[model samples]
Target chain A: MKYAFYPGCSLEVNAAAYDLSVKAVAKTLGLELVEVDDWNCCGATEYFSQDELTACAVIARNLALVDPACGQITAPCAACFLNLKKVDRLMSEHPDLDQKINQALAAGGLKYRPGSVQVRHLLEVIYKDVGEEGVKARVKRPLTGLRVAAYYGCQVVRPFKDFDDPEQPTTMDEILKWLGAEVVDYPVKTHCCSGHMTQISEPEAFEMIRRLLYCAQQREADVIACACPMCQLNMDAYQGRVNGFFNTNFNLPILYFTQLLGVAFGLQPRELGFGKELVAAEPVIAAKVGAA
Target chain B: MSVTVKSKRFVDEVIEETPGGHRLRDCIQCGTCGGSCPSGAEMDYTPRKMIALVNAGRREEALSANTMWSCVSCYSCTSRCPHNIPVTDIMYTLKRMAIREGRVKDNDGPALARAFTHYVDKYGRSFEMGLATRYHLLNRPFAAMKMGGMGMAMFLRGRMAFTPSKIRNIGQLQAIINKARELGGAS
Candidate 1:
């Protein structure tokens, strides 16, 4: 299966691991990802707070850039996925806004026909296009003993009903199970990671992060497999601070699902962007997925 | 005792500012948003109470409240609101309003938010290192100093970039942004 891939800004820099693993896993699964040419940022969560039109217009520009023949564009970053999906949904729902946004796009010699492209999260494509059995059939080194908590974060399933159950998503869980990993029942699976809050207010943000980590720890998850880059960043990077603040000893490895899939596919950890994480995945890798 | 009259004008202005907030009037005073908020304890006004402040035309109190900055935009309240009130969107509107009116409290939320916005405006995408450095140096240098070790780790791991990846046709992006600002403000 092939789709237009919108990697967004995070993939190019901080979340490079997610980008690498996504490409590696997609190649392993025979999914073709045609990168959208010259795509810009998706305005993330911060820009929309400042100005609605500018934010939507920026995302609309990327939508217009996608190859229309592909019909579907898969965004791996949850924030990008939501921003792209949101602009498409809003434009279709409100024609006036669509008209205004299109006028802005027109300046760049682009025009996004809302509803022409189906914006989907990468996990959705993996679940729907490449079914669980399909992924399982390709697993070379099964992650049989590893326990995973599928962290959906907030955007992927909430505000609008997308691919999975918003309140209780299982696409990640099911996929992990397919790869021979143990999927734990995490009640706060849909909870917030406070996204950029870790940068803004550490005390408040750490509290929320503490709960997610504490819950995953309680469930005895070997690693928290996440789809969003921001979630992975906050959960992994601030783990030290959260531990420092709460006076708890927690060392949870936050990894992208694709990275885990890459391991299951017997791919190299470095190729999957393994060691780039703040919280070390080496112990888990050595214990479960094998030596780096 | 003074009577609390609902300020229709303030509520209408907020509703007009953000189309996503059209359902503000539909709020049934349900505390679901407040109850579900993870940072409710830190908020000066709960989402439920904030909406009431808006309804009652307590514009100054509502706009200046620290509650809006505490919002993480997790969509928990928006997703679970009984009346389907776009509570988070309303929060967004409130934040924008707060920022515009210069009512932002002395907090890291607004400081960091502006830092993020500044990078997006300049690079057409966020520059992580630049944002971190700029925010720390300008807003909280001591905290930045404290986190120097963590920064070094990120740098060594190549997680932080020294430069931003620029988008082609940046001029076009700027034009689009300028047009949006003009059109957006005209409304």
Candidate 2:
């Protein structure tokens, strides 16, 4: 299966591991991902709050570039997925927005008719297209004895409920289970990671991150598997900071679901961008997948 | 402050300007939004109280409240609101209104908002390196120096680019922004 992939800005920066592991997993699964040429940012969450029209226009510009044959697009980041899916939804729902956004697109010598393409989150593609059996067939190294907490964050399922139950998504859980890792009860799985909240108020953002990590730790999760770049960055990079703020010593490693899946597929850790995270996954993987 | 005729205009304009503005009228002053909010404790006024303030023509109080910036856009309040009032969207509108009206009490939120928008406005995509530098430089100079350790770590990992990766034919992007700006709220 081929998809036009829009690996938004975070993939190039903080979430490089997610990008690397996504590509690695795609290769192992035999799924073809074609990069969306000349893609711009999805305008993230800030832009939407700043100017709805300009944000829609920014996303519309990228939607207009999808190859018709590969019109089914996948975004790895939750924020990007939401922005793209939202703009598509709103453009169709509001004729005024549709006309105005298209007007902006026309300035770029492009036009995107609303609903011309289907937007899916990367996890949705991996779960739907690859299937459990497809993943089960390729586990060279089963992740037995490894317990994981699946972190869905907010944007993937909230406000829109088709991919999974918004309140309690289980796609990532099922994927981890298929990869032979024990999935733990993650009650706070759908909670926000305070996206960019770290910048606005460090203490508030730290508290939000602490809740997710503390829950995962309480449930004895070896690592937290996530689908969004922003979620992973916050959990992984700020894990130490959260521990520092709260006077707790939690050493949980936060890995992209694809990174763990890559390990199970027997891909090398360095090749999957494993060593770059602040809270290293080396020790956790060594005890789990490496040993198995 | 007393609810004067001019303050009533505040309610009228919000109702007129926002897409979900009419939904605001449907709110029953329910505290569900405040209850569900992750950052509600930090807000000067809770989401529930903000709605009531808006309806009561307390424009300054609603806009000046830390509630607007404290909202992390988690969608928890919006998704769980019994009235289906787009509380989060309303928050967004309030934030923009705050910035537009220059009533923002806290600089961090509005500063970050402008930094992100300005970065995107220039590069067509966010430049993390540029955005962080610019935001801290302009807002918190001392904090910029402290971010050195994290910056060095990010640099070593090749996570950030010193230079921005610009989209080809960025002139088109500029034109699109200009057109969107010209069209104002409708665009």
Candidate 3:
């Protein structure tokens, strides 16, 4: 399988673990990810609030840059995946917006046709493209004892139920099961992680984070597998603060799904960027999966 | 006559501007949007009430409320809406209108949005450290101090970068942004 990868801005820094693990797992799984050249930020949710047209144009620039050889583009970050897919859908639905965005792109000597490139999330590629049999074939170290709460977050599934059920997604859960991990069927699996809310409003953001942590803990999951950078960052980084605010002693490791996949594929933890998480996924992985 | 005209204008404007705003007319006053919203408790007006305000031409009250600012863009409401109304997109529309009309008082949402976009407009990629520093220092200095320990941990773990990464074709990216800004709304 091949894709035009858009790592987005978070992968460059805060979510570097996700980026590393994605590359490692993809390589091991015989997936080729050719990065789009000079790809800019997808502007996340902020740009849309400021100026909708500008936000679409900014994201469309990336779509315009997608190499013609690769008709499909895949993004690991939920926000990036949503923005790219949403803008493409918008352009396809609204011709006037398409013309306006194309005009903006024309300023930079570029143009993109709506629906030209198929937008996909990394999870979808692994789930649908790789298939269960393919994943089962590559699992050198089965996570028999590991209990993973697969956090879907919002963007990837909601508002665009292209691949998975928006309300009750099972892609990640199925993938984890393929790797021999116990998938926690929690109700809040598809809940919001309060993206960018932590920066704007702490109380609100922490409460949102606390809910997810509390649920995962209640379900007795060893670690929370995240498919989005913001989800992992908020859950892992501010977990201490959430505990402080709520007076709850909750310690859960939040990790990217790719990292766990890499571990199951017999890749080293260091190679998959393990110790980078604030909650420390290493101890849990070692204890449960035996030296991942 | 004037009251009727004003009521029609606000709803029409929202429907025209928002991506899925045309469905605003399809709202059935069901509180499912508010019920499904994760941040509903913090919001001044529930999304259901906001849509009501829009329909009733209570534009000022809807735009001035912290409802839109508190939205996490979760889209739970949008997906769950029985009427298929794009509740999240409507929130974005309200936010844009509020910011444009200078009605977003005492809200960090707009400020954060500005700080985030400032870097995207400059370097084509977000500078997380710079964005956090600028937003927190300007809006919530005490909060910034409180987050110092977390920041230190991130830096130590190589998760936070001091310098922003500039794309190779920044000039081209800027040109597109400027043109888009000039062209204005998608309509």
Order of candidates by lDDT, top first?
Answer: 3, 1, 2
How do the candidates rank by DockQ, highest first? 3, 1, 2
DockQ value of candidate 2: 0.60
Please give, for residues A1-292, the per-residue lDDT of candidate 1 as tens digits. Answer: 8799999888987889999999999998898999988788887888877778888898888899999899999999999999999899989988889999998888777898999999999999999889978898888888888999999989999777758888898999999998999999999999999888777778888888999999999999999999999999889888887888889999999999999999988899899998999999879868876664
Give the DockQ (C-alpha) for candidate 1: 0.61
Give the range of the ten consecutive residues with the poorest summed lDDT in model 1 chain B: B178-187
Error of 3 at A203 (Å): 1.0
**TM-score of model 3's chain A, to 2 decimals?**
0.99
Q: Report the lDDT tens digits of candidate 2 across residue range B1-187.
A: 8875644477777776566578888888768889988999998999999988988888888888888888887788878888788788788888888888889885588888778988787887799888878898888877677667677777787777899878886888878877887777533
Q: TM-score of candidate 2 restricted to chain B?
A: 0.90
Individual DockQ of the candidates? 0.61, 0.60, 0.78
iRMSD, per candidate, in listed order: 1.5, 1.6, 1.2
Residue A119 displacement (Å), model 1: 0.4
Angstrom error of the Cα, residue A33, model 3: value is 0.3
TM-score of 3: 0.98
> How do the residues A1-292 of candidate 3 rate in per-residue lDDT, one tens digit apiece?
7789999999999999999999999998899999999999999999999999999999999999998889999999999999999999999999999999999999999999998999999999999999999899999999999999999999989899879999999999999999999998789999999899999889989989998999999999999998999999999999999989989999999999999899999999889998898998888889988974
- Local accuracy of candidate 2 as per-residue lDDT tens digits, A1-292: 9999999999987788989999999999998999999898888888866887887888888888999899789999998998899889888888887898888888878899889889999999989999989999999999998999999999898767789987889999999999999999999999989988888788899999999989998999999999998898788777776877899898988899999899999999887998888778889889776643
For all predictions, the C-alpha RMSD in Å is: 3.2, 2.9, 2.1
- List model 1's recovered fraction of native interface contacts, to 2 decimals: 0.63
